[model samples]
Target: MKKILSFFSYVFHPMFISVYAVLLYFFLTDRYHSYQELFLIMIQIIILTILIPISMFYFLMTLGKANSLMLSEITQRKIPLAINAFLLYILITQSIREEVIPELYFFFFGALASTIITFLLIFVNLKASIHMIGISSITIFIIGFSLHTQVNHIYLVATFLLLTGIVATSRLSMKAHDGKELIAGFLVGVLPQIGLLSFWL
Candidate 1:
């Protein structure tokens, strides 16, 4: 049971949320973007959100700044969160343009907003579960995307809802966060996506 819960944590780590969201967006949309274009976008997202962050995490670990990939410590979160926000800013402004992919653009925009809020919350000594934030954000994005595209993705949404519960349970079982932190993270993750729905949804 412990090993299974731990697997969920790694599988749904916050670092991979953007890629998952992007892939799901492509899957659900009937957009006319070519395979080549979609491939390029995926490469860009992987490089920025995954590759760079992983490299930085290693460097931070070597420097004794970050102890784990989970960034379980509040102080360890600052630099990574800042880097994430900057990268997300770059992604939205330069790569995922609203003119081209409005839905994805707003999805990432909402992601950026959530990242900033989570980072700000650090100052107040609050450590909301990044796991919860990541899972919930993508879950809400999936919901919003379904509505915007008018696709009946009820099963997909239900699957994510189940995954959200699994993630929450995993975090709690691992002693990574309390219920309050999970709730806080869930709210932070969903609110921005919900708020940004008017623009593209």
Candidate 2:
């Protein structure tokens, strides 16, 4: 369940949304697209997409450390504002053309949700949580498919939220996170993503 949730979250995060949205736009305009065109585009995104976010995620993590979002600034409210910059990068770039997934908004929510799950797990043991989230993501996806909830990303998002709750609770029960630190972690993960949902703007 955890793994499936993570997969859908990763697959549908904001960055991925840009890629998928572009693909959708292309299909709407082209009206007669082919499978080969689709494959080539996804290949382009999959390879290059990882490069940008890896660096950005690291930078944010380091900033998180320095700001004490991890172990330092619990009271100061200095949660490494770099995540905002990362989201800005996603909003702008994830939708680049030659796009395979083409429907960028879908990609946006997927990547955004996935990223959220990743950040939350950071407070715990990332290696273990990631494996759980990823596997759970796929399982839930199948369940969602079976249930016929494809129009909205609701199934995956719901799974993501529930699993995140579990992980957060686990951390709390383990005494790995104090109240302030837990809030900081959530702020670090969520605030910036909420900031980047430019559709409202």
Per-residue lDDT value at 154 in model 1: 96
Across residues 1-201, which tens digit of lDDT does each residue of candidate 1 receive?
Answer: 989988999999998999899899888888777999989999999999999999999999999999999998999999999999999999999999999999889989988998899999999999989899899989988888888888899999999999999999999999989898899999999999899989997
Please tell me which predicted candidate would have the highest TM-score against the true structure: 1
For model 1, the superposed segments whose C-alpha errors exceed 4 Å read none
TM-scores for all candidates: the values are: 0.98, 0.35
Whole-model lDDT, model 2: 0.43
| Model 2 lDDT per residue over 154-199, tens place | 6545765675565555545544455554455454444433443343
Whole-model lDDT for model 1 versus the true structure? 0.92
**Whole-model lDDT values for every prediction:** 0.92, 0.43
Q: Which stretches of candidate 2 lie over 4 Å from their true place?
A: 1-45, 48-91, 94-154, 170-178, 192-201
Candidate 2 residue 136 Cα shift, in angstroms, is 16
The true-versus-predicted C-alpha distance at residue 42 of model 2, in Å, is: 4.1
Error of 2 at 95 (Å): 4.7
Worst 10 residues of 1 by lDDT: 24-33
